[model samples]
Target: MSTRTDTTSQAGARAPGQREPTAPGFERLDAEYVLPLRWSEYRTGDVLELTDYLVRIAPNLDVTVVDGSPDDIFAAHHQLWADLVRHVKPDGEATANGKVAGVMTGIRLARHRAVILADDDVRYDRPSLERMVAELHDADLVRPQNYFTELPWHARWDTARSLINRAVASDYPGTMGINRDLVLELGGYDGDVLFENLELMRTIQAAHGRERRVDDLFVGRVPPRAAHFGRQRVRQAYDDFAQPARLVLELSLLPLLAWSIRRPLRLAGVAALAAALAEVGRRRAGGSRVFPATSALWAPAWLLERAVCVWVAVGSRMLGGAKYGDARLKTAAHSVPALRRKLTRADGRPGRGRRSTTSRPR
Candidate 1:
């Protein structure tokens, strides 16, 4: 039960806490949650939760981490990715894929039959991974849905924001597994896109491949810090650039609300109905209970914030900004490099001046 042992095997077999590597020949039939890991000083409870999940799901691989550092005993799987230049808020433009770019790039190069990308933010059980892999049997790409867990007061304020997102946008799960070859054919994900997963799926569909959302099985992500969550209203609004359909839906909400304001009863009815739909979505987005009915109080705030943020995003685009996140909000018209090439093929890990190391935060 404790994964705190100091010793580990020389051959890079998994330890109690470390995740098992992808099976040889890249022929794994089951889907696993792939975490492209960076080092962490995890709390005991967090570590224990992660440990239990890994141990209980051994071989089944509820989760897998792509380690950049060589400290872990199970470091061989770290070799799966070529060192690219990874960085947390890199200097040039933080346009690169957030966490899993390296893993996705590695899969592209290894020509792996399949790989799944999962970030450390989410809270989920092992069965969710099984559902995703099962979905992949018939589709080229599969994404799960996510809801916020741990409704810190700030998260409750943003609850409606997330709900509106679920209603209008195609849910880009906190994790996804896809065929490497398909990614290669689509030229990989557009690294600079604010919504890389959506961009990835859009490219896949453009190529005439099958893609689907496994909605019944859900996952959860850490609630954003209050400050970050506020900025996220605008930042993610900018991300909708990739999902035009959602973008249009979001845009329509403003005018609908404006009209509803002229009729208080009608406005209240619509708001209440939408909030109920949001709660329904939350229920379906499988995860432990956390949302408060009172959280729905923030739905109006979510609507107003999205409306204003969409304008901010559009204004930045008009000003020629490239991508958005971390509130950099800079404007640059130059194009970024291919997502695959960003992860350079050197030393099985990154070489200096190529890319920086990954930083683990929400």
Candidate 2:
């Protein structure tokens, strides 16, 4: 792989893996990849810890921070990260989902074809980082599993969600590795969706691109604060709208429980079934290594929470849409058929081609 200069900042003059003053005592690794860490914040609480992680990984990857913070906070972030990484404000007009704008800007500013996109709370060590980049060699998009580093009570409660997802299907994670050229070719995914990660994955698949879900490749994520976790309950349940089957099942959960109320044994059996499914998931894809054995016990509780929250999400939808950033977003994600139609229209345009000609090893 070859390195390219980052036109977004003067720091691009330095070669890939070049050490900056802030990143002392760490030698640059021989990996050829770029990491686009995209985030938007009105506050600066996580800046210090995130900066430390960036400094350590700066020597291994060409890092770019696409910040969507207010001017003052953005300036503060630039002052801290300007030397160790390319720091830039998110370009282009804002969208309903601000994170997608930052992600698009970071991809546009990325210096390499192999790009790793991550949220602020994601932390990748050298080994996992390298493996993600390597996997992108044969895939258009790579989805890795995420495990929280420090498991608080809330984190363990959320772990049950991941366990159930692992049992049924791949869990959607905070980070993904992508081939920049392919995403660009697809003209990027919709920025108006609530579940942006799922939107991106479906967009890739709709374009007939290869998407590799690496269940065994675990990445570390910083758990959200308890209060933040509390706020996300209904919003997280609303994401199920993206998958109709899941949405229907969750919507029916309360009614099912109510019907089973007359028979206590049936309610107990339902909870046991949920726990058993979570346990099966916990035991899949080496989940036992990163997920606690006790996480399965929380599955029934998580399901109950979702049973109520899904109704709240429905009410929010009926009122208008879910509140995201400064706007309300009605769609969770575009259906695959809808995305395919959009891709077809793009391909039919005079200057666009049906697919990108970029070569990838099979």
Candidate 3:
């Protein structure tokens, strides 16, 4: 093994304990790798320490923690792409480095067929990287399901508001290994690569003409840096949970409008009134005959709850914006392109490949 770093080598080499054996006249499937970063709340000087920790823990995974100010780095060393994020800026903008930044770097240096865009805050255990890499044989993309590591009180409140976001993910169909070509083929977040999970799923679904797949490739638990009550304290932007709105819109409104003429409001109204009258009559009869005791009281509560649910459904149908996020980045979907250019500039670009020698170890 040799001790050197460069764009090509850093991105392409295996970790300390890992071996990079290639058949004669054939290059290994390993591609260039990168971790885009722009720390917020966490101190700047702590970055090197963080990278050092990563190297120590998984030296096989070469990481460069690039600083936003100093553009200079060893051309041979693994590059750590960096950017500046401010509290004043929107949350999404502040953390927009990984998608475009890391993706772009991988595109530049990787010898492997695939380039992975990973997050810095995520903790990858010993088997994690290998598993994700292995997934490439079947699919183009591999998005690991992430568990919450830390959180704030407000964040917990936000999470609780959404009914569908309780678990790591909803009970959907088969695991999808989203192909990279599917994403690139679709031009992936063309205007803004600062995408959330749902956006990624939608993109995959759109390109492949099928929903995104799920798998158990990467299983990450809460790291020590994460909060003890991580699930409750974690706060995500409103835009991150896009499913709620889409689900509500599709389930509530589109069907109503499409079928309005056939059923008609008048017909629905008459049916509802009839149902209500029937319900009241049954309750009255049960109060006097069947239950004769609890029905006089329990029936009212049951009816009220049912009525409220129906009312909410009607309103949800009328309103388009039904889903909510802990924090919302209320910008036009159209505004992504303009924002993407700015983020790409902030992330900067990687240089050409560099070569370095490793120790001639057995």
Give the C-alpha miss distance for residue 263 in model 3, angstroms: 36
Candidate scoring better on lDDT of 2 and 3? 2
Q: In order, what lDDT does every prediction score? A: 0.53, 0.78, 0.35
Q: Which candidate is the best by TM-score?
A: 2
Q: Report the C-alpha displacement of residue 237, candidate 1, in angstroms.
A: 0.7
After the best TM-score superposition of candidate 1, give how far the Cα of residue 137 lies from its true spot, in angstroms: 2.1
lDDT of 2: 0.78
lDDT-better candidate, 1 vs 2: 2
The digit string of per-residue lDDT tens for model 1 on 61-124 reads 4334544333442332222211211112112222344443545534543423455676656655
Clashing pairs in 2: none
> Higher-lDDT candidate among 1 and 3?
1
True-structure lDDT of candidate 1: 0.53
Please give the RMSD to the true structure for each candidate, in Å: 10.5, 6.8, 17.1
Error (Å) of candidate 3 at residue 245 is 3.8
Q: Rate residue 77 of model 2 by lDDT.
A: 67
TM-score of 2: 0.86
